[model samples]
Target: MAAETAAPAESARTWLVGLVRRTAFAVRAALSRRDGRATAVTVAAAYLVAYHLGLGHLGLRAGAVVSRPRFDLVVVEDPVALATRRVAPFQYEPVALLSAGPVEYLFAPVNAVVGLALAGLVGVTLAVSVVAWRGPAACRIGAGAGAAAGLPGILSGVACCGPAFLAVIGVQASAGLLAAFRWFLPASVAGLLLTLLWVGSQVDPAAAR
Candidate 1:
């Protein structure tokens, strides 16, 4: 009876291992292709375009004057005020459809450029590490680490407020967390560099030299 149970468990483990190996092989094959770099850049550009046009808006503020028997007050509300009040880098509230204007057109390109830069850096790092190690194992390790490092930055871009992953995971997204959001880009870059270094170290020292 114990042998029967062990047989099924061992078979399950073997199946799982095969599935992982096949997935890794596919990913490595895709990344090793000549057009892989171009594909990465195009994907990065698409993400930026989505972020700019789909997620961003331009807003204007308008004020109303109220007169009382004894006093007068002017109440104001607008995009500027909302932006100021929100501690998050991006606004959590939905932008009105009509609010987007020339301002969005002007700023969207800038944001896209920044996004492209970040994505390009990641792609280059992955490519270089793969080349340095010259193996599917290196490609798999580098790609996994690179993706992990970029998660925070990607969440920062996608979230209406601060880092979306933290919020989704039930973290409060405190002031410190919001501030740390800005560091994600640099952190990803650093992580990629470390991945490359680690992969290089794993290689034959004579070959690495």
Candidate 2:
């Protein structure tokens, strides 16, 4: 019985290793090409756009309703509803509102600039990782790191003034939630820089071959 179990475990381990190796090779090859990098950037930008437009929620407004404390700010998709107002007594009322229209219209140029910046960051990270690892492992590492770094901005954009990052999971908008961008803006930039440095270190020859 022990021998049989051991044999199956060994087979599974070997299979997993082979699968990882193949994936790594494929990822490395893709990132090595200019077209692949462009495609990746395009896909990332599309995801960002979709997320900003609230498509990330798949058109669902409110998911599961649960009781929670009120927030300090509320984000709305319409420019007309961007003003502050009172809610109820004892409950925290929203003192500010973040309108998606202003985010998209008034700061339209800023959006372009941020998008370009993210694309460049991802491209550079992928390029460097490909050089250092020379396999799918590099692509995986680069992609993971990029996603982690970009998460703050994505959450901020999606949440803005709703219910924190809860909207990403289909949660309904809540009152008094703070604007995510107000805090995440600087955090995203810091995360991006930290991720770049960390990824660069991962490829260091002195650390590993």
Candidate 3:
């Protein structure tokens, strides 16, 4: 029985892997439209996405007095190292408590770059989210709904801030949360209101009212 079960499992694994490989190839062909620039299209698209996802940090960049990032994931226990009383309170720096680091996930350079493309995805979603907030009465609804569906970066930024430029997720998760639970129409309206306030706050504290 054990031998028979192992045989079937091996067959299943082989079949699944082959199926996935075939599907991936087929998808590439279809998306490339047979002209064969699917790889280039994918790369260009990825960069456009990363640029926008990198913008989520605009809020924090705009908000924070300190705009530097602690790359290397190296621990900094020295309070003096921070050098600012304005320790990005909103910035997540848990020297003692972090989930797992993503070392095993991207084992290859190709894998790392593909993962980097993910930052673009975060950017596009925020770009859409910001766009959604602007249009008409429906803009708010569209913005919140778009953001909720597309944003996995909302929470993942805690550990995923590796490619420093893609810092948008770390900053915008709160705004994303505010949009997600607030029901589209109402949330959109509220977000529109708050966004106006956020903009106004940038201009003048009294104007924020």
Q: Highest TM-score: which candidate? A: 1
lDDT of each: 0.45, 0.43, 0.35
TM-score order, best first, reads: 1, 2, 3
Off by over 4 Å in 3: 31-115, 119-209
**Tens-digit lDDT track for model 2 on 1-209?**
99999999999897655554543443355566775566556656764554334422222223322343222335446433332222211112222333332132222223434545654544444444443343435444444443443333333343222343465567664454444334554565565455544554333232232
RMSD of each: 16.0, 16.1, 19.1
lDDT string, candidate 1, 10-96, tens digits:
998976555545434434444666655555556556555544543333323233222312222222346444323433453333322
Off by over 4 Å in 1: 1-32, 50-104, 108-113, 126-174, 203-209
For candidate 3, write residues 85-202 as lDDT tens digits: 2222222222221112221111222223433554443333344334333431222233343334234434333222323432423544455544343243233334433433232222
What is model 3's C-alpha RMSD? 19.1
Residue 99 C-alpha lDDT in model 3: 16
Best candidate, lDDT = 1
Task: For residue 77, give model 2's deviation from the true position in Å.
Answer: 24
Where model 2 places Cα greater than 4 Å from the true spot, the runs are: 1-31, 34-39, 51-107, 122-176, 205-209
Which residue pairs come into collision in candidate 2? 24-136, 71-176, 71-177, 72-176, 73-176, 75-161
Clashing pairs in 3: 49-120, 50-120, 52-123, 53-123, 57-168
The 10-residue segment with the lowest total lDDT in model 1: 64-73
Using lDDT, rank the candidates from best to worst.
1, 2, 3
